[model samples]
Target: MNLKDFKAKLKNKIWRNVKAYFYDQRIADSTLVQNINLSTAQNQKKAIVSYVTYSHFNDWENNNIGRTQPFEILSMVKVLTELNYAIDIVGCHDLKTLDYLKLKNYDLIFGFGETFYQLTMLHPNAKSILYMTEHHPNFTKIEEQKRLDYFYDRKKKKANTVRTGNFYWDHHMKKKYTHVITMSETEPFNTEYTKPFNIFPTGILNNNFKLKPKNHDSSKKHFLWFGSYGAIHKGLDLLFDVFQKHDDIVLHVAGFYKDDRQLLEFPNKKNIIDYEYIDIQSNQFLEIIETCTYCILPSCSEGFSTAITTTMRHGLIPIVMENTGFNRLNELAFFLNDFNIEYIDKQLKEYSTKDSEYLASLSEKVFSFANSNFSIHAFESKFNVILNQILKND
Candidate 1:
């Protein structure tokens, strides 16, 4: 390995070891085990699960992309608790804990993302469920592409792309789990799970995002590409190119772009406004949302775009590509044919000419849709129904 790459690997190894050591200590706490197992005496069903942590639920700190894990987990816990179910939380990071717990004995096993598949598989008789975060296979392809690009740029010999397949890649995991649940709007790509795949939409705090007076002039209407990290993977590269070509439509770019210097090349000139990394809860966030008629996210893949939904809650319509994983993009928003720059440009141009009255009507439609679909009430109702279904089928 090259000196730079070797140093990077060594640094990562040290960091991982450090984090692992602290996590081991945290899980070792005696009170931690008892607290999760606590339940009402009348409660009948007791579930044992692992991997999901309180830190996952803390949205403000994690800066979660969408479907705040804490809210989703807490909502599930609330439903289970109300049903008189005792939940024993287990930390999946430590193999010792898994061995000690005997996961199969629990009435239900709750797991999130791919790793839990193996845990569930180990306990064949365990009544388990997997709550997948995204369309994993598609996401993997993107990661693979990025790795290959890095290798190519470095002029490395025999640039081999490594495919690190996770639980999402394994179709058999479908049969392994009792049933699969996802935050995604549609069925994941290349899936063999014939059983019930429940689609539970994510919840958004109603008070956090409210409709504000927007600039009514259609001619001056701009778009905001609110994203985080993974700029290239999120298709910000394509967005930058597209925005540079179109002077008529102002595209305001927001969010943290890590290691992607291409954004620096496209100065905040022409019709582009680069407001890098503003707090979503800040007044500045609302101000930018108010100025824009549409929130553009031509993402390559997503389990669900929280940015799109959050913006819609503030009454900005969605302009997205097909595979954004948000199924509700039908009549309420505009869909790009592909992630091509030309297609995005064409779509933006078409949207730019839309009159003020039409934009106002569209905004109302989007707002109503967001309120009905993305609210906490809607989330709870759907969650309760799914919980009932899971129990009934079990």
Candidate 2:
């Protein structure tokens, strides 16, 4: 093995150990081994909800794109707590297929993305809330060509896995829940299609998105993208080319991938700053966004990027690509760009936060836009509306 690879491997091992040592599980140990039969408590004005996430604890902070479904659950839990209900969370399925958790006593589950679909089969009596990201056979059809692909530049990866063989994807045995939860009136998700879908986003602690006073070299502007880079939808390869021709500009990356990918080694760019492996979907990620100059996501596909909303919260000017379920791309998106380098470069020169005047213009509007539409209170109000309605009938 190469020396660099060996050293990086060592660093990864050390970092993993460090995180395990310090990352607080925040879970009460008393709740761990007890037999939790939520079904028995079924109608007690309390709920025992189960969440089946697309990701888990290891990836929750180990990589740059890492997020915590637990934190999201906790936010909803806090809301439900105020409403006088209790909830429990466990991995959707354990390593062994036979060990899946299924009991018919829970009230509702707000499961995310692909994991929600499979987990629904486990609890037929419980409400199955499918909160999914954009994917094939769901949002954009294969016929929408020339459009960018979110999974590693390949159109095939973004295709409907639900329709593929042995995928055995089905929803017949399981019935759709009365409520489907999602955020915004955007792409990859259409409230029209999934009626009674509630728009509930995670609430942000203001300090996390509060900006600190710092010196700015208004002349040396930066463009930003904060999300996972494992796939091409993040437009990293496109940035490699953009950096080649522009020596004055810089790129700030955060959200996923610990090390710079081999494809992002731009020769001419002054600097490439990376904030890898911060627990975003967790509560910590908001702090990172507040500290950033501005955040951008040129994703080829998205239902609604968590980073995009978080960035906007902290007054980071965002640049976005128009794609699946990205419909609410209103004032939140300041400088939108196509994936091609030439058009991007031209826009960057004109619109980037390169001067005090330009920064001032954007700064004035940033926080207000986020507060009005992206606050936790707003999320709770909408979500509770649905919960109240459901309970009224039940």
RMSD of each: 7.9, 10.4
Number of the top candidate by lDDT?
1
Cα miss at 393, model 2 (Å)? 1.9
lDDT string, candidate 2, 179-248, tens digits:
5555533332343445545353542434434455433454226656666644344566566556667656
Error of 2 at 233 (Å): 2.2
Q: Estimate the lDDT of model 1.
A: 0.64
Candidate lDDT values, in order: 0.64, 0.51
TM per candidate comes to 0.77, 0.65
Kindly report which residue stretches of model 1 are placed more than 4 angstroms away from their true locations once superposed: 1-43, 55-67, 90-96, 136-175, 188-191, 200-209, 218-220, 261-270
Per-residue lDDT tens digits for candidate 1, residues 1-394, read 9999999899999988887668755543432243353645554666755555553324455454434555666667777776666776655444455555553355777765333555565666667877665655555476547634643453342233222243355453435466777666435523555664655455354345666556668523588888876665566666777777767778888884644553335455678777878776677887787688888887666666777777787788888766556655688888876665567777777788777887888888888888787766677778788778778755
Cα misplacement distance, residue 134 of candidate 2 (Å): 5.2
